[model samples]
Target: VEMMENVSKYRYANVPNLDAQVVEIPYADGRLSMVMMLPNREGLHSLQTLFRDLSYSPLASTLASLRETELLLQIPKFSIESKLNLRPTLEALGIKDIFGFDANLSGILAGKSAQIGSVLHDAKIEVNEQGTVAAAVTGISVIPLMGSTMDTFRADRPFLFAIVDQSTGSMIFAGRVVQPTWAAPSPLG
Candidate 1:
């Protein structure tokens, strides 16, 4: 057919096509992961950009408002395993709600955190050994908890993001986002 011929021609000419496979990984730990196989970096970048825009755009506000009432009506019941089991320490820390599971919260958090770091960087405030701004302080100062110092020390460093193969539990990709998009566009551009 003409369409098949055109597609073959385009493929031979190295023209990009919108053909990618998305794999969903479900964990026994109640976490869901997604892996998208894109043809090139451009496709990945565009997808990321679209996700960012959808998350922070005014349209999200309207959609969120519509869903807020429905969400509020549903009281999440904690499972026995969730209450009594002591795995995934972060979950035990009252972070039961997985906000970044979707593009909305993930993009917003990435953007906002990047923005915070940018503002701090712009201010040029000196960071202490514990990664705290020289003049800035938090409740940890008044908490007087024994493990608080350890937590603060651990939080003083940058974090990395990684993608792992669900079946094999092997790391497929690892990288760090130095600056959030809200803080600045990519330096490569």
Candidate 2:
């Protein structure tokens, strides 16, 4: 575990639908940022449910309403590396063809019969007192309305966070931090 202590002005909101608070912390240049969505009360089930029903339109509307305020923030320092094979999840969503023999991706492969072998996704995120540093690889893959005075946010419990390109309104990396622990040394390391 690492220490997190800071006080600054940031964009923030509290959503009634999700019963959570979201705080956006910008990176050095200000065009990119890390957004932390944390439940006001204990437990992440409500936040998880909100994510399941998430869509761009609702998210945009929520973000568009955030207000600026001075925040006293404390977020734990943590790091995580996760990899997922999307085949099963995709199949469950009625996308079975891509992983089967009958699949046809010829349009992109120029008539060569092809099917996906393994859809691998890897993601990583790290956060500390200064800001957040995060990255996600091999993956293709908010909100609220509120106006308040000085705010205090402490991410000592489970929370979901994201790194985004503010200029393009594009998400670069996102993950949940349920518990902070030291990561085992990577095989490559």
- The most accurate candidate by TM-score is 2
Query: Residue-wise lDDT of candidate 2 within 65-153, one digit each (tens)?
Result: 67887665566777789899988888889998888899888887986988898888988766643335222111111112266445777
Regions of model 2 farther than 4 Å from truth: 49-57, 87-117, 129-149, 180-189
What is candidate 2's local distance difference test score? 0.66
Give the number of the best model, judged by lDDT: 2
Tell me which residue pairs clash in candidate 1: none
Model 1: which ten-residue window has the lowest total lDDT? 1-10
Model 2, poorest ten-residue lDDT window?
Answer: 135-144
Q: Write the per-residue lDDT of candidate 1 for residues 1-189, one digit (tens) a residue.
A: 000000000001111232221122222242322121222233345445433443453322222222111000001111111122333554558654442333244455655422211111111211122221111212122222454321111111122223344445454443322222222111110
Error of 2 at 149 (Å): 7.2
Candidate 2: the clashing residue pairs are none
